[model samples]
Target: ALALYVNHRVRVPGTADIVYWLADEWDGKGIFLQDADALVYPYENLKKVCEHINEKLPFVERIAVYATAADVLRRTPEELAELKRLKLGIIYMGLESGDNEVLKRVRKGITAEEMIRAGKMMKNAGIRSSVMVILGLGGSELSERHARETIRVLNEMDPDYVGALTLLFTEGTPIADDYKNGRFHPISEFESLKELLSMVEGSDFTDCFFSSMHASNYLPLRGRLPAEKERMIRQLKTVIEKADQTLLRPESYRRL
Candidate 1:
């Protein structure tokens, strides 16, 4: 997570040393770098981190981290392959929203096509790609467009996993400021569920696991795409039709 007071990206010094120390202490099979964008580290440094971990802790089977579309694109094919060889197994990337205008508004810095390319790149390099899209990101204005385009992009990417998160306005963020000024409107909890429903219904994936099981979401859903798609869709429709607050996650429980 970014520090509340500092806006710019901050790279912790000796990240590899830290990971090595943690792995040595914990002796776990996996190491997940929970930084905002682990791939943002320079390629040589990233490789060294992996190499150091493998050399020091051969029992560690895999390494994972959060990444961005830009981060994936910045690495060369050779570098990605090398990382995969070093057991850099999976990456979680936030697609946020697929509507171009909505993406521009949020300053995601990459088009939907670019995001798809990045995902495909990771998959081609034998790295599992888990893509996340934010529900209600377009607010009430572009909700439908956001869902439709996001489904389209997900279909194109055919990622190994898809995680759906609902939009939450932090107090100090620009979106929250817009909400306070009435410049932006957030969709209701039920509306967010509807958006998630559209994504589950419209998505066409080959053996992909799709879910809205994040803490930020009102409804929690998880299933293999295409196979359990109908079951998941029916579940969402049932919840929406009932519209019972008791049936959904309470606001107090939701968080970023």
Candidate 2:
């Protein structure tokens, strides 16, 4: 099981104290330090927190967090190795879309090449990397390019885990405003599923676990790559061909 640590107090009072607080309040095998750029937190400070968790709560097996390509790039090889040694087992990064235009539109601030380097760096340092891609981030206009290029980049990164999430707009966000003012048009649910199909069909990985099991997705799929690749692809194809809405999650149930 996993415990979430997202309070702003985690930043002010320090991560180690928060770990102590969590240890008192919750019991779990893993802790998901939920921050937008958790790795950007000072290396020494993070290392200390990891050390405290391992020492104070020996049952916690993994420490995972959300990170960005820029955050990963800022870390030196030695620092990453040190963090891995301290039980920073995995990192979850958002590689929202692999298409350059989409990346620019979203202002991700890092190129696909840089993202590949970050993923490889984590792998070499013995830290598992889990990356996420948004299914309909390009809206209807660049849907195919988004899917195909994402597959290409994922192939290059070959992360330990790949999570496929469908696009959703939060209120007052620029993308949400764009949708309101006719500047953007999101693909339909089935179209998003089609994009997912393309990703599953095109992805090539050594031993990664690929999944579209996020709550935002219409369908849930998970399997080990290359080994279960064909079976997963066939499953997606059949779902798409059937076009059965009842087989998919209802829109009301989906959330960010």
Candidate 3:
């Protein structure tokens, strides 16, 4: 049986790492003011904070932080290598969408090329990269393009983990406002499944744990890519063929 560790003191090694609260938001556009709410501590201050944590918690096996693709790409190879040496094994990033047009629509600033570049750098530095892509991000009109481009990008990056989340707008967000003004068209559940299916079919990964199991997704699927790709696709196809709501997560169960 597999050994389980819970509620125990760190007698041996532990996986929990201190997530240093560096910044509230990433300046993907490179236009935020110094006093803006987007960034929390400046880079120098963040480094000092990380150093302090490392000094205090020398036994921790990993340290992680969330960053935008632009922010991550801004890190030089030396910085990534240094971070790896510091036991910072992972950097979580939001790719959102790989289609440049969709990225522009969302004001995400960084292009798909930038994300790929950053992923390669992180991989080379021995950092486990966890990245997310938003489904239905391009609305109904560009759904296919979004899926195709996202699959292409993921295949290129081949990050350690891939998270797929369906798009949902919070109140007052630009996308929500666009929906109110009839400028955006949300994809139906069935249509979203088609997009997901297309993405899974098109993807070609060496080894990555891919999942659309986020709460926002209409259906949950998780498996290793290429190895379990066919099984995942078959699961989705079963639901599509049945056209059964009972087989799918209900709308009331969906959450952001």
Candidate 4:
């Protein structure tokens, strides 16, 4: 809240929130719940915070959330309505990929079926949801399946948004370790882009928001719905089919 005030960005009003009782590292000790996934406070404490914000910064419009574990919220349809009544706006969830192979290889710890359930449930609660997909997560062995299964899950979830992110072996991670030992082979930027488009083509989602405009992405593409989605995918594919690999983004710049 203070940061938003300081930034003078009244753009999207509501604040983001999180609840993770299961990851409460402080739960075992005398200390009740500790912040792990994010700050987890008592339900009463949360109500107080919302009340305080409403009383003071009434302009605050929406409350965005990214709760990894939906169990903690224990939110029913009525409860979600209560949250909206309290000015909670949008909720984002990561359906990383529908491919179980890619998910486990990345230690995502969430199954495709579970993601499908969670995402659809979130939409049912009137909370806007976001799903993320990673290209090249399955290496060459499962790349095609990764794209195919990912689309399968997306159709099942049909989130309001789908974020397509590239995979990279960042230094100091388990992925990096695998890279050094030749256990993993990183895909080129071009193939990653193709894989992203494939994920979309194989899927039958209609209005999902698409974005890869992050700095790390080789090409930052974003759009909404059928037209914009096709346009963005075509634009990216053109870049890949035409651009020379030797002359493409240099290693100093590309991450994934």
TM-score of each: 0.88, 0.86, 0.82, 0.76
Error of 1 at 115 (Å): 0.4
lDDT of 3 by residue, 71-153 (tens): 66667788778767866677778888889999999999889999899889889999888889998999998999999998888
Which candidate leads the pack in TM-score? 1
* Model 3: residues with Cα > 4 Å off, grouped in runs: 1-44
lDDT of 4 by residue, 1-256 (tens): 4434323533334644322222223232111112332213445565566666566656656655555634424545665566557665555556666788788988887788877777666767676667777777887777878878888998888777888777766788988898899998877778777787786566567677778765467777788756576687678778888876663455566553
Predictions in order: lDDT: 0.88, 0.87, 0.78, 0.66
CA error at residue 63 for candidate 4, angstroms: 1.3
Ranking by lDDT: 1, 2, 3, 4
Q: What is the per-residue lDDT of model 2 for residues 1-256, given as tens digits with 9 covering 90 to 100?
A: 1123432223443446746566557655687776567888998898888888777656778889888888889999999999888788999999999999999988888888889999999999999999999999999999999999999999998999999999989999989999999999999999998999899889889899998888999999999998998899889888889999998999987884
Reference-based lDDT, residue 85, model 4: 73
**lDDT (Cα) of model 3:** 0.78
| Model 1: residues with Cα > 4 Å off, grouped in runs | 1-27
